[model samples]
Target: MIADAAKKLRENIQKVIVGKDEVINLTLVAVLCEGHLLLEDVPGIGKTTLARALAASLGATYRRIQFTPDLLPSDVTGLNWFNQKKQEFVYRPGPVMS
Candidate 1:
């Protein structure tokens, strides 16, 4: 079942990201192994593209957060808003939660 899902994902991702079959395969392997993949290379080699493609292929929710000097943890974690009707602070699920 997982293999079928992964094949479907790979096919879907190929539509947008051309070539780089090795990267895509490795990404899928990492995902299946329950391990994280470290793709370190020079810029413009489709690192972000590969990530996005894999996310797209899996039919999974995708979120891209840029790490910068002004980026805050709360920004990624989302904020709690008080609901007047409920009279309580609601914890909004962040991108990671998705």
Candidate 2:
């Protein structure tokens, strides 16, 4: 079952990614082992593409956070806002929450 699932995932991701079978396999292995993957390379080298493809192949929710000099921690983790009706502070989820 695991092999079948892996094969299906690889095939699905291959539909968008042309090559890099080894990378795809390694990504699958990492995901299966509950590991995180960090793809660092020159710009426009398909890092985001690979991550999106992997997420799609695995039917997982994918969210990307672009860090900039002006980005704040609250932007990623969200903040509390006062609700007028409730008269209480409500935790608003950020992009990372989804």
Candidate 3:
């Protein structure tokens, strides 16, 4: 049953991503095991796309943070916005919070 669900998920992802079944299956294994994956691949090799595709397949919210020299911690955590009318700070959730 888990295998079937994974296969269906893969099929759903394949609609958007192409030519990477083996890698997709390997990534799906981690997902099935409820473990996070560390994909150490070069740029433009579909790593991000694969992650996004899988997230879409499972109806999960997807977010990508690009690590760069100038990246800041708050970028990932988001900032609190002040609502003048309410006179209180409202917390705007980030992608991670989503």
Number of the predicted model whose TM-score against the real structure is largest: 2
Superior by TM-score: candidate 1 or candidate 3: 3
What TM-score should be assigned to candidate 1? 0.72
lDDT of 3 by residue, 14-78 (tens): 88779988888888888889898898888888888888888878888998887788977767787
Encode model 2's per-residue lDDT on 1-98: one tens digit a residue: 98898899999998988878888888889988999888888998788999999877777888899999999899999999999999999998888897
Q: Rank the candidates by TM-score, best first.
A: 2, 3, 1
Sorted by lDDT (best first), the order is 2, 3, 1
Candidate 2 segments exceeding 4 Å error: none
Higher TM-score: candidate 2 or 3?
2
Error in Å for residue 13 of model 2: 0.4
Model 1 ranges with Cα > 4 A deviation: 1-5, 84-86
Give the Cα error of residue 53 in candidate 1, in Å. Answer: 2.3
In model 3, which runs have C-alpha deviations exceeding 4 angstroms?
none
Write the residue-wise lDDT of candidate 1 on 49-86 in tens digits: 88887776667777877778998777788889899999
For each of the candidates, give the backbone clash count: 0, 0, 0
RMSD (Å) per prediction:
2.6, 1.4, 1.9
